[model samples]
Target chain A: MARLAVDVMLKPEILDPQGQAIARKLPQMGFEGIAGVRQGKRFELVVEGPADEAAVERVRKIADTLLANPVIETYEVHVLSDN
Target chain B: MARLAVDVMLKPEILDPQGQAIARKLPQMGFEGIAGVRQGKRFELVVEGPADEAAVERVRKIADTLLANPVIETYEVHVLSDN
Candidate 1:
């Protein structure tokens, strides 16, 4: 089996309130020096084949169509393993 | 500046209905051969320092305390870049 990863993140221009909330709480929790934070989604897929270029392309299409909202989000696909 | 990533995922033994629902919908959406899907959280942190071991350790601690629930979830930290 092959493993692939799809990371979906909001556009840089968009406001990420969730990330902001965490950033705001960091100092209070004694975690300092964090300039910014952005929260996103990670999806791992176990597919029945080699994690080759073709598989990456297929996963990219899947990410574009289902995993990410093009209107405000973008996605990146990576092949984690081929075994 | 340094950029770090913390990926928080549910433990393997934990149930993931969100992943299941996506897996169920994949075939119907013309995406096939995906045996399983696991969804997780990805946090990107821009810190005001070098992305060294100390930064990684700090991010790991932040991940453990705030980004992930140690009871049912686990997290991994990676240094994306150091500038």
Candidate 2:
């Protein structure tokens, strides 16, 4: 089995209120010298079949279809070690 | 600058309500056959000085101090391709 690593993040231009709240509270939480902390989602899938172009397509279809909100968010894929 | 990739996620056993809601809503969004989509945060940091044991220590300290919540969450560190 191979793994497809995906990261779904809010666009930088968009205002990330959740991230902002976290960043605002970070300093008070005793986290000194930290500039910013943006939170996002990562998905690792146990994929089947040959680890080839086809696999990439299927994985990305999953991303485009359900994994990401293309309007407000974006995603990136990383094909990691396969078995 | 080198990058230290860290995955900050909710503990496995913890109730990932957000992820569960996402997984529930995914299929309806035309993402068929997606069993689950657990949500997490990945941190990529650029550090100076030597990438040695000290760097690792400093990085983990950041995790403990501000990056991760010890009580309800956990985090993992991955030293990815450095520049």
Candidate 3:
């Protein structure tokens, strides 16, 4: 079995309202010294076989087409385990 | 500056409807060979200072109390960069 982790984040130019809310709430909650916060999505996938180039490419396609919106978001794939 | 990443995932025992939907949709979308898919939240935080133990702890506290719902989710914190 193999595992792949995809991290999808808002583009640097995009505005993240959810993260802004957290930044505002943090200070109110007495947590200080945090300058910024950005919230995103993470997807963990378990593939039935080895996480080879083909498997990675497949996941990348999924990430690009389905998991993330290319206009406002970007994604990166990491192979966590391959065995 | 320092960077902290919090990954919040549904507990294994819990049912993830969103993930299930994606898993089912993947095959229909022409992506195959994936056995399971789990969706989660990833928070990227930028601290004004070093990402030491104290900073990590503060973020952990934030993650525990505000970022994640303790009932249905579990979270892990990773210090991405410290400078």
Which 10 consecutive residues of model 1 chain A have the lowest summed lDDT?
A58-67
* Range of the 10 consecutive residues with the lowest summed lDDT in candidate 3 chain B: B47-56
lDDT of 3 by residue, A1-83 (tens): 89999999999899999999999999888999999999999999999889999889989999988899999999889998999
Residue A58 lDDT, candidate 3, scale 0-100: 89
- Candidate 1 regions exceeding 4 Å error are none
What stretches of model 2 exceed 4 Å from their correct place? B1-5, B10-37, B43-59, B65-74, B78-83
Candidate 3 C-alpha error for residue A50, in Å: 0.7
Give me candidate 2's interface root-mean-square deviation: 3.4
Over B1-83, each residue of candidate 1 has an lDDT whose tens digit, in order, gives 99998988899999999999999999999999999999999999999889988899899989988999999998889888999
- Cα lDDT for residue A6, model 3? 95
Q: Which residue pairs show backbone clashes in model 3?
A: none
Ranking by TM-score: 1, 3, 2
Tell me the docking grade of candidate 1.
Answer: high
Model 1 gets an lDDT of 0.92
Residue A17 local lDDT, model 3: 97
Candidate 3 RMSD computed on C-alpha atoms after optimal superposition onto the true structure = 1.0
TM-score of each: 0.98, 0.67, 0.96
> Which one is best on TM-score?
1
